[model samples]
Target: MTDSAEVPTSRPMDAWLDALSQPTGSPGGGAASGVMLGLAAALMGMVAGYTPDVPAVVAGTGRLDAVRAELLEAVETDGIVSARFGAALGLASDDPAREQRVREAAVEAARSVAELGRIGISLVAEARTLAADGNPHLAVDLAVATEALEAGLAGASLNLRANLRLARVHGASAAMRAGLDEEVGRLAAARTQVERIAAELSARLD
Candidate 1:
């Protein structure tokens, strides 16, 4: 299992993190968000890959292809966002006047992370639904997909929370914090529902 946080930018997950960690101007929250979405899509693709040739599998293949395209796009955007966030964080010199600017930048980054997390959570839900209805011969594949989706969701949530904390500590506006809190709550709820479904499906297969 690849650690999304440690994924290389040259590859995909680690690639974005590497770019974000660099002093260069690349990788941003948008790119990171894209990666999260990509992972969710990849999980779905894995499920489909495990059950190729059947009519139901064929249908899933098309969906997974679309998801892959979207994830690729998301990776680019997430990288850009990560780069911008890194630059913004670096610019905070701790001066009182610069604090507001830093907070605003952090808020933007947090919002981008939240957006990606939301998208990731949604993809997990969709993948779970597809897996449930997908080829029975590949039920174990569905289990794998569920585990991958959970990992993606958890990673995305971590990123979102970290950014939100940065924004709050740096003096982000109350409205911004409230918005983030709301989105995080919603995503958490959605994750719970998806997890329940995945658990049920996995147990049934077992």
Candidate 2:
């Protein structure tokens, strides 16, 4: 089995962690969250097999396979964006308006992270449907998977908010802040939905 913290791809898990553990920034929390999201999708695919509807199960399995692949891609993207943001922060002191460049770069990274968070939420929502309709015998597994996805979404949100805080310190435009607020609001609703699904699944398990 692959390590949960590493990207769910062909690369060895330890190889990914070797890079993540480095003092350098990229492949940090944001990337790890993406990995978790992919893992959740994998779990969702497993539980989908337990559903009574053969066609729906096949469709869910295929959908989750695609979702997992996309999430793995996002893991790489997050690392790339983090590197870019780190580079921006490295602007030489002699460079005129260096602070402005860093702020802009930071906001761009934060936006991407927030967008990934939104994607993670959507993936969870899709999984919730499958889990809700899964076999009662596997209810606990479904519930655990939902919780794992929720935790991953929450982690992504934390990273996004941290970047946004930096952007605020750099005096981000009011409109940009408003856009972030709206994104966060949407994530909040998704969380509530997951909680309800988890509750329903848990009730069935009992």
Candidate 3:
């Protein structure tokens, strides 16, 4: 059995999340989007790993491969941006004006993270649809994929909300908060959808 912690980062998908957790770098929003996308792809991979030679695998090959590649790339990019944003946040001076600047920077970071979370919702939806339609023989794997995607979506949404709060503190206008509220609502909806899908799939499997 492969130990997840021992998995090599050089492999396309694994590196992004690994890099995100590291103390040294970015992997903020862009990287986070990639990570979420990668996670969706990873779930797809799990489905593939179990489904064997089903026709859907061949039909959906291109889409799955593309998602997988994009996820890896996104993870790397998210890492870079996260690092830069962190550095910028740290550089803000202690003066009142500088404090405002810091808040602005933090807001930007929060927005970025939220955007990634939103992307995750979309990717997870796609993966869920594919898994459901793909191979009944591997229904259990499909169920696992759904669960993983939901976990990623939920985690990303939390990150986004935390960032948005920072933006509100930094003096974002009421308009900004309203827009973010809409996004938060969407995240909640997406999470519910994922959870429902997982439950349905699990019930079917049993």
Candidate 4:
């Protein structure tokens, strides 16, 4: 079995999936979303590379590569942050530091997913452009990439929503809470847009 603590990039698919399936929340849902985002970026890079005739499309390969690297790095980072957040929340209610620990964890957790959401959202326009103009032969790949991007954004929003509740309970400031609320809304809108793009592409599949 791949150690749950190991980064997803280091393990076999089955082993990583096994670790993810366990009750342990270390490589929790947020980490899974990060992997999804990374996968989307990888697929986008392939589509862009194959589109040699379009200089703009080819130019996007560099950005996709950079995004893929950052999102994959986030996969490991989110796992660690998730584990920390879980540990802090697991502290006994009566522990003198329990409230403070939970507050800090919730803040960290929210920030992690918020950043993930932003990075993932950044690719939405690229995916839409690729879907419309990339090599027609790679439509399936583009559609699949859109779906993965949608799923990643959805997961980030879900995780962010969960952490917001924790933050509210632990007394995060209203201004910060409002910012996260806007994040959740933005993620949902981006996911919906990608979902529409995916559906349109899928409809065109032979």
What are the lDDT scores of the predictions, listed in order?
0.66, 0.78, 0.65, 0.88
lDDT of 2 by residue, 1-206 (tens): 75667845556787898899997888888888888777778888778876757565667777788888888888899899999888878889788877787788778778877767877786755666676466667777777888878777877778888888888887788776658867777777777787788787778766
Q: Could you report the Cα RMSD, in angstroms, for every candidate shown?
A: 6.0, 4.2, 4.7, 5.1
Q: Identify the leading candidate in terms of TM-score.
A: 4
- Model 4, position 131, has a per-residue lDDT of 82
Candidate 2, pairs of clashing residues: none
What candidate 4 gets wrong by more than 4 Å, as runs, is 1-15, 175-178
Report the CA-based lDDT of candidate 2 relative to the real structure.
Answer: 0.78
| Candidate 4: C-alpha lDDT | 0.88
Which residue pairs show backbone clashes in model 4? none
Which of candidates 1 and 4 reaches a greater TM-score? 4
TM-score of each: 0.70, 0.83, 0.72, 0.90
lDDT of 3 by residue, 1-206 (tens): 99989976676446645665777656554455455556566667666655556666555556667767755654554555566557656764665565566566656665665666655666555666565666677677677777767776776677767767776767777765556667777878888988888888889876
User: What is the Cα-based TM-score of model 3?
Assistant: 0.72
lDDT of 4 by residue, 1-206 (tens): 76757756645777878989998898899989988998899898889878989877877888888899889778888888989998998899899999888888988898898888889998998897788779988999988899899999999999999999988899888875657888988998998899899999999895
lDDT of 1: 0.66
Candidate 1 structure quality by residue, lDDT tens digits, 57-132:
5566766677768667655665566666666767748656566766776777667666666666656545655655
